[model samples]
Target chain A: MHIPDGYLDLSIAAVMWVLTALVIGLSLKKVAESKNLNVPLLGVISAAIFAAQMLNWPIPGGTSAHFVGGALAGILLGPYAGSIAMASVVAIQAFLYGDGGLIALGANLWNMAVVNVFVGWYIYRLLERYSKFGAAFVAGWLGITTAAIFVGIEAGLSASFRYPAFVAISAMGVWHGVLGLIEGFITAGIVSYIHSSRPDLEETSNAVISKVPVAFIGVMILLSPVFAYLAEIVGYSEPLENVAEEIGLAEKQSYTGIFPDYTIPGVNEYIGTLISGAVGVVIFLSLAFMRQHASAD
Target chain B: MHLLIEKTVKSATSYFQDFFIHEYSRKTYLHDVHPSIKLLGTLAFIILSISTFQVKKILLILASVYVLALNTGLDVGVLAKRSSLFAIFSFLIVLPVSVFERDVVYLITFPLRVFASISSLQLFILTTRFSEILYGLKKLRIPGMMIDIIWLTYRYTISMFRDLLSILVAREARRLKKTSHIETLKGGSKSLGLFLLRSFEKAEEIELAMNARGRKISYRGKYRAGFFYILYISGVATWWMML
Candidate 1:
C-alpha cells in the first residue's frame, strides 16, 4: 500500500501534499487546544504501534497478516491524536527504514493516517452506542477498505500502472477486505480487552454528523472526472463507434459532428473543452440534487 | 510453530539492535558531514530523481548515489539488499505500465527512478545517526513539540523493543505444543496489550523523572556547514535545474 516515489503523477502527489498538510495543521491545532495533551503518551503509543506492526499474527494456510493499526490508534486515542501518532510512525518508516518513498510521504500519510484514522474514529463513535465489538469491527474493516479505495483511485488516475479504475478498485477492494476482516477481529479483541480492564479509557464522544456535508462535497469533486467519462460513454457516440469498429461493426455515421470529439461547434478547442466540462458538471449536479430530494422525501 | 515464533521475535530484536550498533560504530566522510546537510542533500536528490521521467537522468542519479555510498565506506551490497524488496515491488508495480505504454523509455524510467529514490534514502539512513537526524530536524525549525515527541519516541523504542522481545521470549519458552491460528492470535494480542501497558507505565515514570530534574526535552547540538556542504547543495540544485 505504500506508494513509492515516481509511481504517482507529480500533480496528484502535490494535491495530496496540500490536503495532508491542511489536515495535519488542523489536527495540531485541535490537539494544542486540549489542556492536558500528553506528549510522551502519544510518542510511546506511536512507538508501540510501530513495534506492533512487526509482530505478524498467523492466519490459515500458513500465512500471516501484520497489523496496520490505524483504526486501533483512532480507537485508543481520539482522531486528532491518532492521526498524529500514525503520521509519526509513517514518517519514521519512510525516513528510517525506506519502507515508503520520500516524495510520496504526503500521499501515504493522507491515505494511511488521516483517512483511516478519521473514518475509523467516526464509525466507532457512531456504532459504539449499540455494540462495542460491532463498532470496533466495522471501524477497522471500513477504515482499511476506504484507504485501499483511495489507493486504487490514485494509481488509476496516475495511469502509470495502466490499471483501469474499476480493475484497481475491485482488486484492492477484495484484497484489503480480507485483510480488513482480520483487522476487524484484532481491533475488536483489543477494544474488548481495554474495555474490560480499563473501562475509563474508552472514548465516549458522540459522532459529529456535521462533517457529512463537507465529505459529500469532496466526493462530488473527486467524482467529477468519472461523471464526465460516464457522460462521454453514454451521451456521445465516439466510444460506441470505437467499440463497434473493434468488433467489426459498420459505422452508423460517416460524418463528424460540429463538435468533433466533445468540441463545441464554433468555439476554440480550449473553450469547447470547458463547455463540455461545464455541461458534464451541470448534469452531475442535477442528478445529485434529484437524488438528495428523493431521499429526503 | 514454536520455531516460527522464536525466529520472528529474534529477527525483530536483532533488527533494532543491529541498526543502532551499526550507526554508532560506523565512521566515514558521511558520518562526519553535518546531519542537516546530509538530510537536505539526500532529500534534494530524491526529489530531483522523482521529478524527471528521463531514463538517462535517473541512471545518472543512481550512479551518483552509488559513488556517494561507496565514498562513505558502506557496503553497497548491504545497501542494495536492504532496498531490494521495495525496488522489486516498484518494478512489479510498473510492469503493467510497460505493456500499455507506447514508448519504451517509460518502461526503463519508472523502475529506475524508484530504485534511485529508494537507494538514496537507504544510503542516508545507513550513514546517518538517528539522534543526529533529530538534531538536524530541530535546527531546520521543525515545531519544538513535534520534535520532542519524535525524540521521545526514538528514545523509548529501543527499551520498549527490548521489553517486547523479552515478553515474546518468555511466552515462547512457556509454550509446549504447536498452536492453532486462533491460539497464536490470542497470545499475540495478549502480549501486545501487556507490552503497551508496560510502555505507558514507563512513560509516566520518565515524565516524573524529567519533572523532578526540571529538565526540558531539546536537541543540543552545533550545526556547521562546510565548503563541501555548499558545493553538494549547489551541485544538486544545478542538476535539478538542468533536468
Candidate 2:
C-alpha cells in the first residue's frame, strides 16, 4: 500500500503534505502536553510494530498475510501518540528501504499515519463499549480498508495514474477490505490476549479532545470550498480537474484565484506548488495557533 | 510447520541484518556528501523524474544512476536485481489497465519510471547511514521529537527482533508434533501476543532507566558538502535541463 514515486501528481502530493504536517504538528503538541511524555514507550511500540509486520501468518488456503496493526497501535496508544508512532514507522520505511517515494511521502503519511491511525482509533472507541474483540476486529479491518481507499483516491485523482477514480477506489477498497479480515483476526487476538494478560497496559489510551484541534479541523473544512475556488480561479487545472470535467462540474460553475493550480504566477508548477504549500502550511498553523491562544486567553 | 517457522526466522534475521549493512561498509566519497544535501538532491531527482513523461530522459537517468552506482563502489548487479524486481511488480499492477486501454506507451513507460525511481533511491540508501539521514531530516527542519521517535524505533526494532527470534526458536523447539496451518497460526498469534506483552514490559524498563539517567535521545552530526555533492547536484541539474 506504500505509494512509490512516479505514481502521483505533484498537486495531490502537495495537498497531502499540508494535511499530514497539520496532523503531525497537532499530534506532537498533544503528546508533549501530556503529564508523562513516555517517548521511549512510543518508540519501542513502534519498533515492535515494525518488526511484527515482518511476521507472516498462514491463512486457510495456504496463503499468508502480515499484520498491519494501525488499528492496534491506536487501540494500544491513544490517537495522538499512535499517529506519531505510525508516522515514524512510515518515515523509516521510506528512508531506509524506499518502500515509498520521497516525493510521495506526504500522501503516504497522510494515508497510513493520519487516516489509518485516527480511523482505527475512532472506530475502536465507538465500538468498544459493545464488544472489545468485535471493535478491534472491525477497527483493524476498516482501518486498512479506509487507508487503501484514500490511496485509491489520491492515485485516481492524479493524471499520472491511468485509471478513473471509481476503479481505483473499488480496486484498492475491495482488495484490502477482503485482505483486512486477517488483520482483523490478528488485532482481535492480540487485544484479547493483552486484555487477559496485562489489562493495565490497555488503559494507556488518552483520547481527550481539546478545543484547538476541533477548531482547526473546522476551519480547514470551511476553507476547502474557498481553496476549491482558488484552484478554479488560477486557471491551472489540477489532477482532480479531470474528474470535475468528466463529471461536468468544471463547466457548470466557475471561480478564479490569482494563483492558478495553487502555484505562484510565472513559476514552475512543481516548485510553485512547493512554495505555495509551505506558505499554506504556515498560514494554517498560524491560524490554529492563534485559535489555541485565544481560547487560552 | 518447520518450513514456516524457519522461513519467518530467516526472513526476520535478514531484515534485521539489512539495516546495518552500511555501518560496516568501506567509506566512499558518497559517504562524505552531506546527508541533507543528498536527501534534497535525491528527492529533487525523484520528483523531476516522475513529473516528466519523457521515456528517453527517464532511461538516461536510470543509466546514469547505474554508472554512478558502479563508480561509487555500489554493487550495480544487486541494485539492478532489486530494481528490476520492483519494476516487474509495478508493471504487473499496470498490466490490467494497459490491457484495458491497449496503450503500449503506458505499459512501457510506467515500469521504466518505477525502475528509475527505485534505482535512484537504492543508490541513496546503500550510500548513507540511516542515522545520518535522520540527522538530515533534522537539518531539513523536521520535528525533533519525531526524529527521536524514529531513532528509538530503529534501535528497539533490533532489540525486539532478537527477542522475537528467541521466542520463535523456543516455540519451534517445543512443538511436539506437526500441526495444521490453523494450529500454526494460532501458535504464531500466541507468540505474537507474548511478544507484545514483552515489548510493553521492555518499554516500562527503558522508561524508568531513561528517567534515572536524565538523558534525552538526540542525534548531532556535521554536514559538509564536498566535491561529490556538488557533482551530484550538477548532474541533477543537467538531467533537469535535458528533461
Candidate 3:
C-alpha cells in the first residue's frame, strides 16, 4: 500500500499533496475543538498501532498478515483523530524507516489514512446502530477495499507504470478484498473486546457537515465534465491512453460520436463539450440535492 | 509458529537498537553535517533521480550515491544487504514493463531510479540522528503539535517495542500444545489487545508525569548547516539542472 517515488506523475502527486494538506488542516482544527483531547495520548496510541503492526497473525496457508489498525483507530477515536494518528504513523514509517518514499507521502496518506479512516469511521458509525461486530467487520472490509481502489487508480494513472487501468484495478481489488476480510475479522474481534472491557473509550461523536459545503460539492461534481474537457483541451489525455501510447500499444477508438472526449456529438466540439458537461452537472447535482433533502427530512 | 513470532520480535527489536547505536557510535563528516542539509540532500537526490528516465543520468546518480555512502563511512555490503528487500521489490514492479512493453529505456531506468532513491534515503538515515532530524523539522516550522506527536511516538515506540518483545516471550513460554491456526490467531489477538492496553496505561502515566513537570516535549537543538553544506547542496542542484 506504500507507493514509492516515481510511481505517480509529479503533477498528480502535487495535486494529492494539496488535497492532503487541506484535509490534515481540517483534522487539526477538529481535534483542537475537543476540550478533553489528550495530544500525548494520540502519540502513544499511534506508537502502539505502529508496534502492533509488527505482530503477524498466521493465516491458513502458513503465511501471515499484519494488522493495519486504521479501522480500530477510527473506532476508538473519531475520524479526525484517527486520520491524524494514522497519518503520523505513516509519516514516521516514511521519514524514519524509509518504508515509503517522501515524494509519494501525500498519495500514500490519501490512500491509507484519509480514505481508510473516514470510510471506516463513517461506515462503523452508520452500521453500529444495528450490530457492533457487523459494523466493525464491514468497516474494516470496505476501508481497505476503498483504499485499494484509490491505489490502483493512482498507479494506473501514471504513464510510467506498466499495468492497464482495469488490470491494476482488478488485481488490487481482488487481492485486497481477501486481505480486507482478514482485516475485517481482526477489527471485529478487537472492537468487540474493547466494547466489553472499555466501552467508555469508544468514540460517540459524528462529524457535522453544513449544507452549504454539501451543496458546493454537488455543484463541483456537476461541472466536472467541463473541467475534464478543459483538461483534455490542454493536451492532457486520459492516463490510460497516455500509458497505452508509452507502451507502444495502438490507441483503440471505442466511441467518437456525441460524447467523443465527453463532448456532445452533434454540436461543435467546444459547444458539444459544454452541453455534455451541463448534462453531467445536472444529473449529479440532482442526485446530490435529492439525497440532501431526503437526509434532512 | 512460535519460532516465527520469536524471530519477528528479535528482528524488530534489533532493527531499532541498531539504528540507535549507529546514530551515536558513528563519527564521520556526514554525521557532523546538519540534519537539515542531509534531509534536503536526500530529498533532492530522490527528486532528481526520479525526474529523468535517461539511463546514463540514472547510472551517474547511482554511482554518486555509492561514492557518498562510502565517504560517509558506511559499509557498502551492509547497506546493500539492508536494502536488498527494497531492491527486489523495485525489480518486481518494473518486471512487467520489461516483459510486456519491451521498452528498453523504461526497463533500464525504473529499477535504477528505485535503487538510487532508496540509496539516497539510506545515506541520510544512516548518518543523521533521529533527534537532530526532528529538531530540523521543528526549525522548518512544520506544525508544532504534529511534531510533538511524532517525537512522543518515537520515544514510546522503543519502550513499547520492549513491551512487545516481552509479551511475545511470555506467550511463547506459556504455550505448550500445538495449536490450530484459529487458536493461534485468537491467542495473537489477545496478546496484541493486552499489549495495547498496557501501552494505553503507560501513556496515561507519561501524560501525568509531563503535566507534573509543567513542561511539554520540546525539540530544542542549535544545529545549523555551515557554508560547506550549502556549497555541496548547490553543486548537487547545479548537476541536477544540467541533467
Evaluate model 1: give its lDDT: 0.69
Q: Clashes in model 3: which pairs?
A: A222-A281, A258-A265, A264-A272
TM-score of chain B of each: 0.84, 0.88, 0.87
Q: Please provide, for model 2 over B1-243, each residue's C-alpha lDDT reduced to its tens digit, 9 standing for 90 to 100.
A: 565566667667766666876463656556666788878767766765675565665766677677666665668887887568778987998898999999988888988888888888878888789888888888899888888889999888878877876887799899899898757766776788899899988998998898999857667676556444445545443433322
Q: Top TM-score: which candidate number? A: 2
Each predicted complex: what DockQ? 0.15, 0.26, 0.16
Off by over 4 Å in 2: A207-297, B1-4, B172-182
2 against 3, candidate with superior TM-score: 2
Model 3 agreement with the true structure over A1-297: per-residue lDDT tens digits: 888876765656666676677677777776777754567888898898888777766677756777888877777777777888889889888877777787778888877777787778778878999999999999988888877877777667666567776777788888999989878877787777777776766643344534453344334323433432343344332343344345433223442332457653334678756755665455345334322322111
What CA root-mean-square deviation does each model show from the true structure? 15.1, 11.3, 15.2
Ranking by lDDT: 2, 3, 1
Q: Specify the highest-lDDT model's number.
A: 2
Across B93-197, the per-residue lDDT of candidate 3 in tens digits comes to 778858887776777677777778887787777777777788777777777787788778877887787797688779879889888766766666667767777
Model 2, residue pairs in steric clash: A233-A256, A233-A257, A234-A260
lDDT of 3 at B187: 67
Residue lDDT tens for model 2, A1-297: 999987877666776777788888988988888754478888999999998888877667766777777888888887788888899899988988778888789889878887787788878888989999899889999999988988887787676778887898899999999988878877877888888888887667754656577456435533533442343344233333344345432332232442357764445779867755665455345334322322111
